[model samples]
Target: MTDGQFAPTVHDDIELARKMLIGGEWVGAISGKTFPVYDPADGRVIVEVPAGDAADVDRAVAAARAAFAPGGPWRSMTPQARGKLIWKLADLVEQNAERLSMLDSIDSGKPINEMRFFDVPFSVDVLRYYAGWPTKITGDTIPISYPAASGGRFHAYTLKEPVGVVGAIVPWNLPLLMAIKKLAPALATGCTVVIKPAKQTPISIALLAWRCEGSFTLNIAVIGSNITGLKRTRIRPPTA
Candidate 1:
């Protein structure tokens, strides 16, 4: 081996993508428009990714809503099972730490050392921390003040429940970590998610989203733009 050879700086062997993650599949935007992502270090186009708009966002939201619906695979999973899935995701992050660190470094032009030391580990930590939340999330019983209105002998309690689909819009500066911060808790709490990674740095998020494939009941999609808000539903606390 030559002593003067430098470590590999380009990742030609790694396959990058120009699609978005929608409905558990890698797909292109309906408009077929793609915007180039530049390597911050050299200003050269690293890759082109789908330039998703409202339509793409809607598709992702629909998928998330279906996954979050009653009796759906993601919703029907027991809390303990959900926790295990999240823990598995954490393991996946750890396993791909090096690749992820490289992607972030290339995308954001941050030093590889920073991504390796901070962003990557923190993302894994966030997922692991939230993994324990599923089993621990609990509701409590409360004393009723209007007993007369309740036949003078009624009980009241609250059930902590999922808020359905979550929309996560993360910044480019710390793409991986910020995305995990929004996603880990949502996954732990039994909600599906639609993530819009900032346009400048979508590659790492795309990879992370695809990593969820075959890992669990897929409950996440990576795309662009904003999904329409969920209809407001007032859930009354249970009473007996």
Candidate 2:
């Protein structure tokens, strides 16, 4: 997080990292258990990260639910203010493009150049594109074609609002961009998220989660390795 760059590894961003982001804080699992993340290119173990279970999932879901609660910042902010914050998060993604790409490359064994060129840029674009949506969402008042009872007029309308907390599980392939696809619109529309990363490509998502913790007033939680017992509630918010 120093100098707007995340260098979690000691060897110049070559190693996988060991932390989970939950409730806007970087921490370890409650059970203190971890699993190895290996570099695909060399089949070498890069780092060991938290192996979260149903308990961790519960903790994360609680955080997201609270963040989406009536008085939370994510819920209470005006649409315009929310838009501004989402746009700011996009800017932060662009700002940390290099570090994010590096994390993805080391963890997924993807080429650094492609990650820098495509994944990072697309993530920024997706975020920026969705950032403009908060102020644009509108509801409509529908006119009924039926006669009103007792000759009284009736009004029918549809209100477009964020549904609730989102539980996102992303695959290892294209981790960064995939997470962004799930995250941007949800955040822009005033919904909170609890996301999990695949065991193989957990680095990039963790990195982005860390960046998000610093970038926005978001309650983003990252469950590690597996998604066991995370299906108790809503998996995807309506806004997403």
User: How large an RMSD does model 1 have?
Assistant: 6.9
How many collisions per candidate?
A: 0, 0
Instruction: Spell out the clash pairs found in candidate 1.
Output: none
In candidate 1, stretches whose alpha carbon ends up further than 4 angstroms from where it belongs are: 1-15, 147-151, 224-240
What would the per-residue lDDT of candidate 2 be over residues 1-240, giving only the tens digit for each residue? Answer: 123233434344333247677776777778888888777887877778788777677777777887788987777789888877778878888988888888788778789999989999999899889889999898999866665566667798988888787877888889889988998898887788887888888877766666666555566767655544455643432222
Residue 189 of model 1: what lDDT?
90
Error of 2 at 125 (Å): 0.4
Writing each residue's lDDT as its tens digit, candidate 1 over 112-162 gives: 889889999999999999999999999989987794576575678999898
Which sections of candidate 2 miss by over 4 Å?
A: 1-16, 145-150, 228-240
